[model samples]
Target: MSELASGVQVVRGEMQPWSDQATPHPALAALLTDVVPANRRTLILGPHAPQQIESVLAHSADVTILVRSVADAQQLGEDFGPCLQVIAGALDGLQGEPYDVIIATDGLDRVLGYDSSDLSWTERLGALAGLAAPDAVVVLALENEFSLLNLLDSRPADERHGDDEWRPLHDDPTRPVSVDQLKAALPWRAEVYADFGSRTFVRADVAAAARPGELPTRLATAALESVDVPLLSPAAEGVDSACRAGLLGSIPTGWVAIAGAGATRDVYTQTGEAVLTADQNLTGWDVTITGDATPAFDPAVVPTTVPSGVSVETVLFRLAAAEDVPAFRKLAADLGEWATTSRVILRWDDVIFDGESFAYGVSPWVTEEPVDKEDLLAAAWSRFQDRLIGQHRRHPWPPWMLGDDLVSAWLGMSGIEPPEQLQATSPDTAPAAAVQVARGKELAAALGVLLETRTDTVDVRTALAEAEEAKQELFELKGHVYGLERTLGFRNKAMKTRENRIRELRGQLQRLTTAHERIRGSRTYAVSRVIFHAAQVRKPKTVARKVARRIRKR
Candidate 1:
């Protein structure tokens, strides 16, 4: 092993220079806060988020991080203070004393180097266990092969394959596949967590998961919203189905096992800037929201306990789908009344109705500024409109009415006047109203893009093919029309020629008839006619016959 100037140690020939492709989740950092002790010998394995590394550093003075990438090791050494010991090599090559805490939250798959032999999952876990002290607290994450995310992915197997799968040992017979199997395979007693996106987890096994509107269902739903990948179908409906069957834990995207007790909450979720946790109490559930950043919304405005009822968003969706316009309008009125009376920032999905009264759902956000009643109503309805249209959800409204027009109509239904634009109570807040409108439209368009699945793919391709066929037909028709026009032009010239010939013949006949009339009117023709008539009286038949023959000859 050679040491660099940055104090990063390198076990030459085993270093990986490629990025490990690990995503850092704040929920993981929060979990580390609960389990990782202060001032203890700690070892972090694989490529972890910088946030996670910082959390570890804050807890332990003697911290050693093992990464297969040399560049990452050097970077970590430079970014962190001299107190951190960075090792660049495969896990097998590292020579280290047993650590009090071993964190492999990124999982054991990425710790191997380019030169390292293929290691099975069980063998990797054993290696980690060997490096841990007898009473060491170990936090390890295991990716589930049967995750809902994987099931919902519409891409073909070949398309889904990534560089990380080059040496994946998914066929290892000794590897654990389920949470129970994972717990049984562990050398020490471990508390297993169902990790969804590494942002929401069922930290403890709770019986209330089967009940709708509970922590488990809520966590799964929240995870659906956090998915960054396109899915074949809405995973929310699948998750809901799983929740109904009490099989949510069975289909976790991954499992996070803590070999020692660190997390006490029943469910843990991280939203934008805050972490929301739920702990079961005797009456119902206790929910709390905490964050490091100054909150934009008042924490007091949020509920201290879990609210029990159906989500307002779910009800709205159902009502809209059923085409129950009156019911939807009534619900909108109820929501408007609640917002106006409470004057708290509300998310449609984060509010619950218990048949009579509305309660705040467990959410990481709270709106800080008090909004005008009309604006509040407009914002909620506008967002609901976007979600409905974006998700390709069915509604009672006409097809021609959409986007802002639909939002305006919903606002009017909610008893807001002059719904063409958001009526900001103050001139200073006018910009916020405009921003809200833009944001709603942007979100709708984004959702439409993100949620486009194989259904859309097939539909679009079919439509395009039909369109192309129609275009070709139109081209052929245009060609036929041009040919017909050319033929008509030739016929018109022939008809004009025939008309000119007829006109010329009629003019010649008119001149001949005028000459005959002039001859009959002349005096010489009259005297000749009188003499012919007197001769005809003596030789009547012969003269008349001869005269008629002469006239015919002339």
Candidate 2:
């Protein structure tokens, strides 16, 4: 290994300008801690999360990480001190002693760099296996191109490519497509996980998941919930359908293969400090909880028997999808009566029914406080209502009925009194009401995200018609503006005419006043004014004498 100035060694090949990094997952790290052996030569290939590297370091002192991006190598070198040997090169060029523990949990796609030759999946797998020792524990995660997540993704092929995928070998005919094929391709006995990077991991080919109400089915459903981008359809529905078809293992988000021992658990599902496990019995499964956790419903009410039969959620989904209003109504009524009488908070997906009665599934969530009968019933139906609308599932009810109204209709059909249209005034219902309000806000935000996935393209003719209508509107607007301008011009002309007429009238009045003043100031006009004054003062004779005297003076 030739050490470079940047503190990372260049094993072989040239370093490229790649900057993509994998996200850290705590659950995946924990699983690695269990599978990766201690005090052995380990090689971590590709860009793995720092948490994963840290987990491996906790078990083993000598660890080497290979990454194509020089920046990634520098960062890993800085983050993990001198103990970790960071190599900056392509996977094919790296020559080293065989590793007893080989981890490529981020998969083989990112192992190639910009200057590397395009290698097929089978070639990459062979190269990876060749790097491993005879008794090495190889932990590899392979992404399924035809996973439910990929199948339900609304993004087109052209839009799905990222910069890190310089040349994606997706159409490799020799690569293993399914878990069964992947297991067969492995050289050693391997345990493959279905949901590898998720919060839960399950054995890919667990036969119990084929049944609808089995523990693996619930685990798969919960694990497959969309935490990232919105899917074209509900992942829960896909899981249920796949389970019924005995193909749940065929389309996992990804497969994690642990070859050559060290895997102790078939399923590893944990939330906070709580961990859930299942042991298969003759009939079904016996679930055991390790840590202290509360059920979503009241924990005080525990079922004496194990949960069996299909989930209420699945039944409701089928009825709504089939538009079987009667069956749905009956189920709603049964659920409402049971919840109201029990006065327990319940989630539809966590409750199972074996035809005779309902039992709580192995959900360990808890409500903040106990709720009223109406609140309990409303919450359950409201959750169902959200999934129905959020997933765009078809139902017999009118599309117009939505939100609180649809929830109320379901409650009414359940033979229970619908909740009052008033805020929670009493202190007794305040805590539960607050919880419901917060849940509603969260559900609304989630629903908004789901609705944004709709990629309905505008029809060509429709787009043309809309454009034409907009053009016509623009033409009409321009004409209206022109008419207004004409009217304004006419008004301006009339105003100018009136102004000119007023100026002419002022000129004529000025001329007439000047002529009258000139006539009034004349001497003959003064003499006539004096005569008229004398005639008005005397009688007719006195007026004649005054007129004669005035005439003589003139």
Candidate 3:
């Protein structure tokens, strides 16, 4: 996260010079390139030398760089050589010469590392006041107290480092160094200038901006065009109203306090590139499409005629690391598939890494209706849900503004609308996601009821679906158990019928045996045997043979 503070690396600790801090801020570079006198005494206090410092060193003869870390000083000396004497020492130890120029844009928080410096920012300012040469300039960049960007800040204020020592603002709404405080603390008269987009500061001489409404647009355009980072302007109405009410210069990312010179030298710069002034005096133009914060897409390229005029615009986004490149590749693949098969005729082309940021372009493939706010959101929202969401292999991803949806993001950045932060559910049923989704519902519900507000229909639906899916699974298991119970009941009734049939058969057998036994034992059985004997006696030889056979048988 070692990104540009005043359009240059706010080189704090290690691990960054590898990241966004790879390049110096152009505005700060311009400032140093302009102000650094030839062969004049100068002292730069920092962790590592900024690029502009080296440029200034090339011109100066008596240059001394007092860096915090001994290792950093050695590294800087190795990196920048005999052009400047890199000293590994504390600010208190720096003596023997008064510097003509002292540029400590990165604050005291970085200057005094683990070593506890009892001096506060103002105290440090007073200490710095001791080293300033007559007619010398003291340029210090400090974070603004009333910056709207602070409200939208996603990252924590401090990391491995300590507090932002020279920051005029505090997150706990702690005391900020007032103009009077700075005035009282510094030896020279100080004029604080609003450094917007941190490229240049508004001169105290200018009093107020010629156009205040344009500050928001300027803020966005500055970040995108200058730093190549998408910076959304505040969407708060009160912020804009404040700007309209002569508070445009009041709110800033940071301020440059140029001492030793008063409001006469209020502003200083050799303008690198002027942002938000691309369409300065266009008289009148039709089909004007200004980027609002509610961006439907980002990393998109579009082309259209401004009625009689013609122009093309492109917005590029940088992926944080190499691992994220594949997700964009997958997005391109899905977009291509959607273009070839679906009703949408949008095509994504020219995907390339621009060294700094991932560069990709998108354009409509066919003749279509001119894109409007609603239609753009509608088309993009549909495509995003269908092709994005769970489609990317890297998802559930950190929320990103890609494709044509940057418009929604732009809207939010400009303080005009809100971004559609689509939080995709994780592939596995990680309880974390479920819990977060539940919390979101609870928040949304509470807001809806208590505040009579609405937010994130998509998130609410997603959460509800998650809960219902789990419930439906249980219902299905219950239905299966119910089916088994009905089967067992029928089998039990059949078993009882079988038992009754066995009992009836036993009773029939008993009755039949009783009848046969009674008949065999009856007296009529003796008379029937006598008649049978008389028939046998009718034949004389037969009767004698029968009697002899009976005797032999007996």
Candidate 4:
């Protein structure tokens, strides 16, 4: 077999030991062994033998154990040999990472030198729950008998162990608490299991049982039994008292029986005798009685007259009885008038009636009377009319309130202007029709405004049309200006080129004229020289030579 299987067998054997040996309660052993899987993180609280720690370690390899003292945890480690992580400090050490399972053995009730005045078991349990993951479970193994004893012991004791030492014991006997008190201290939805032989109680799902007074001892016991777990003996006297007080009954389907003043023997006998002497049905019902230990019924306690103004309490009370009681219907009318003049607050208790009795108090003959069909129908109509009128006055034209035919007549009677549609129907409809009439007028007013705005919008459209035409004309003019600017730029460039060409031609003509003048001057001078030389040479052979010679010499 595998090591885990072998370890589990060993642990199981240790739990149930030889028949003669004193073993831990079977339920408790099963709980500790079955709750966590092997190799899971577990936090064990309280004092236990090294063998107990070894047994848990044998089944699970990973375990973080906690104990009240360092010596105890050290001794456990010496035996378990490094397989244990022991925390030796306050329970506050349990605050960080959420553990898979938190096992609290006997240590839950043991608080060392700490003030428990502000620290209740419920609060501590909540603190433990906070350390668990959402799906994590916290197992608290409390001694069942010790629970009651601890409650009583938590009061006071005279013994002195040290300055911080406190005695967990009480002197008062009348204040003894039962398992119910412990159950009341748990949060809602927590499961409580009792190991009668070991005198131990296991609280699972601590988070579920956090609400005060929601879990009763009997319910807790029942829950345990549903899981096939056993519980210690119940408090018979307490159960009897609850039954006698009418707080307990057979399991009800979809509803529960509520205790009333009539359930008590004294109240039933005295009040029933007084009211039932006039009716025969009182003896037939045989209603339960209740005791009134107070002094004789005082007339001063009952109000002789109602106040003038309307009260919500009185209104609701009368409304509740309006169908069956004529006096209640009359009171309702009076209350409606008063409500118009005053403010009122309603208390639920004042309006709720006992299902069996029509009378105000408990009595056998106080059975509810059959409703007067005709009176109820009339009252319903009257009250509805009154309520409608009141609502109309309060809110004549709520934004969502539509004016119908009924509202039209009401507005007409109230001298309010009705819408055209409602005005046409006003003569034929009832006064209660005002609600619809007012709504119609409001709708008409809104529509009229919408229509007027629509008409004005047409005029605005005409002006917008003119403005759009002007904008188009402006855009056309801008396009023309842009075209002109481009043309002017091209024309300016052409003019610049023509001016450059004219300047170049004028320069060339000036150079040519200078060259021609020089050439002409040279040619004229050479020809004149040639003619003078020839004349001088030819004139030397004749008489003319003298003139020529003179000319040549000159």
Tell me each candidate's TM-score: 0.72, 0.69, 0.43, 0.28
Task: Single out the weakest 10-residue window by summed lDDT for candidate 4.
Answer: 252-261
Q: Per-residue lDDT of 1-554 in model 4, one digit per residue for the tens?
A: 11121121111111111111123332334344444556656666655545445556666776776544444444556666557765544354444577765666453544221322334455556666666656554555433333312222322334313333222323323221333443454443334433322321223222122121111222222222222111122222222233334332211000101111011111001121121111112222222222332222222222222112222322333443343344444544442332221111111111222322212112111102332222222222333333333222222334344334333332333233433443356566645334433433443343233212122222223355558989998999999999999999999999899899999999999999998778768977689878888777744567576778899999
Candidate lDDT (C-alpha), each: 0.74, 0.73, 0.45, 0.37
Model 3 misplacement above 4 A = 1-23, 154-185, 197-200, 204-217, 220-239, 260-554
lDDT string for model 2 (1-554, tens) is 67778689886654656676678766677678779887999999988888789999999989999988888898889888898999988888888679999998888888876667778988888889889999999998888877887887767876777765554576788778888788888887898887623666777767335667566777666666624644665676677778889888877778889988564565666544445556555654566555554443233343324555778887888899899999989998887777753334466766887776887776554455555666556667777787677656778888687876687678777776533446667767644434544453453343333223222433233456668989999999999999999999999999999999999999999999999999899998899998888667747787779899999999
- Best model number under TM-score: 1
RMSD of each: 10.2, 11.3, 16.8, 33.2
Scored by lDDT, the top model is: 1
Q: Give the candidates in order of lDDT, highest first.
A: 1, 2, 3, 4
Model 2 TM-score, 2 decimals: 0.69
- The order by descending TM-score is 1, 2, 3, 4
Point out where model 1 deviates above 4 Å: 1-5, 11-13, 164-167, 204-216, 292-300, 322-326, 341-345, 362-369, 396-401, 404-409, 417-554
Shift of residue 261 alpha carbon in model 2, Å: 1.9
lDDT of 1 by residue, 360-443 (tens): 776433344455666555656666775566556789889889866787677666665562555678867644434545544543
Could you tell me the lDDT of residue 431 within candidate 1?
Answer: 48
Candidate 3: what lDDT? 0.45
Q: In lDDT terms, how accurate is model 1? A: 0.74
